[model samples]
Target: MTETTAEIVLFDGFDELDAIGPYEVLENAAQAGADLEVDLVTLDETDLVTASHDLRVEPQGTLGQPDILLVPGGGWTSANEGVRAVVEDGVLPDKVDACYTEGSTVASVCTGAMVLAEADLLEGRPAATHQVAVEDLEAHAANVVDERVVDDGDVLTAGGVTSGLDLALWLVEREFGADVASEVSEEMAYERGEVFG
Candidate 1:
């Protein structure tokens, strides 16, 4: 069987760790024989998005029906406002719903949960985000789950930035096997932490 690929969505001012952590975990999972492919994508095919710390990431492609869509978040300011606008304009909602209907997994990290909520994807759903953004997540009617990672069936969420790694590892365990997850964690020296179901 062909391995499924996951795409991490990047936007201007997105938190670097929010995207990089999960990327690292998934990459490690592939090395551990999980057969997972990962890519960094953006709304535009060629434009480069700048991270919160001024790091630039040029996407390989536009988000095109990815098997998994991971959204990352950062501070809400002038830089992020543009990205938020794109998300709120129904782009994310439409894409996320389409992916979900196609049996693709959806997830978010840190304030990325806020973007999911804004897209109305988290309405009345239990999810996790950065502790600092819990209020924002709640504003969209999502039950704030306090944990490094929250697995609610098809939708998963990770708390804060570094939790993306945990979320990715958990997904590997779910889609492949616990042994693969453990091996990946061992390779990265990442201790498997508690996850909220």
Candidate 2:
């Protein structure tokens, strides 16, 4: 089987849990022999982006098409102004659009679904986001669902911040194996939750 790499996109004012949760989960999957490479990346080649709590995270790579492209959501979701500006005018949409064209698996956590929606990728797909952003999500996609994680073929979305971990574990189990995911969860001391198909 071919190895898969997942690129986690970080931006200014990003939520801490949005990126960290999936990062830890995917890292654990890699350690469990999933052969998954998790990369923290940003719009630029290298720079430190400030999270919502003002925590700085240095990205290892530039936004590149990967097997999976993950986007996170947080305080930036409020008013849709911040996220809209970035998604509509910034590099986030461009990067996601490119990945979509390449048939890459695109996933989002929390309000990150809004970013995808703004990019016109979620127009007719079933997706989930933070409960507070459900209306925003539904506005973009008519098939919005109320669930922890909504897997609509290539587009997978998780609800809220903490759901990212569950999404990552589900991805590992889907792409690798149940045994690998189980082992990784045990190693990380994370309990596996129900996966949405």
Candidate 3:
């Protein structure tokens, strides 16, 4: 396979679990000698990012061309605004759109799939996001589904909050092997649920 690198994008009000759950799984896969590297990235110039829950994290830098580019979503908080803020701003969505020129696989967790939709990435594709926002996704012309994960070629999407773990584990399992993925899942004490295509 090609060189495996994952870039997890973070914005001002990203989701904590949506970003971190997948990070942990990919990190564990790297630790197990999977030849995969995972990095937290952002479209913002500053390295620091505040999650929707007000938790702060520092990204390495802006996004780089990687084998995987994943977006994470957080709830809409009156104070933080989370994915709503991202949708309104369109900065991160622009960057997401730029990644399509690269050969990496693109994916998202929760309403981050909405970010992909906003970027016009899901124009005629079947995708999945948080079920609560299915209407919003459909508005963007995405064939939204209720499944936990939906894979459409290079564009993959996951549902709700916890499904980030399942998506990441499935990615690891797909690129590496069931054994390596199982080990990472066991390390995380997480069950890798069914991933739909």
- Give each model's whole-structure lDDT: 0.81, 0.83, 0.86
lDDT, model 1, position 160: 78
Off by over 4 Å in 3: 76-80
Give lDDT tens digits, candidate 2, residues 1-197: 77798999988777889899999989888987888899999887656888878889999888888999999987654544435557756568777988988988999998888888877888888888888778877877547777788888898999988889889888988899999888978888888667576
Task: Provide the global lDDT of candidate 3 against the true structure.
Answer: 0.86
**How many clashing pairs per prediction, in order?**
0, 0, 0
With candidate 2 superimposed using the best TM-score fit, by how many Å does residue 190's alpha carbon deviate from the native? Answer: 1.8
Score candidate 2 by lDDT: 0.83
Using all chains and alpha carbons, the TM-scores for the candidates as numbered come to: 0.91, 0.93, 0.93
Error of 2 at 171 (Å): 0.3
lDDT for each residue of candidate 1 in 64-150, tens digit (9 for 90 to 100): 777788988777434335335555666766776777778778899887887677667788888998877788778889998788898
Query: Where does candidate 1 stray beyond 4 Å?
Result: 77-89
- RMSD to the true structure for each prediction, in A, is 1.9, 1.7, 1.7
**Candidate 2 C-alpha error for residue 100, in Å:** 1.1
Backbone clash pairs for candidate 3 read: none
In model 2, which regions exceed 4 Å deviation?
77-84
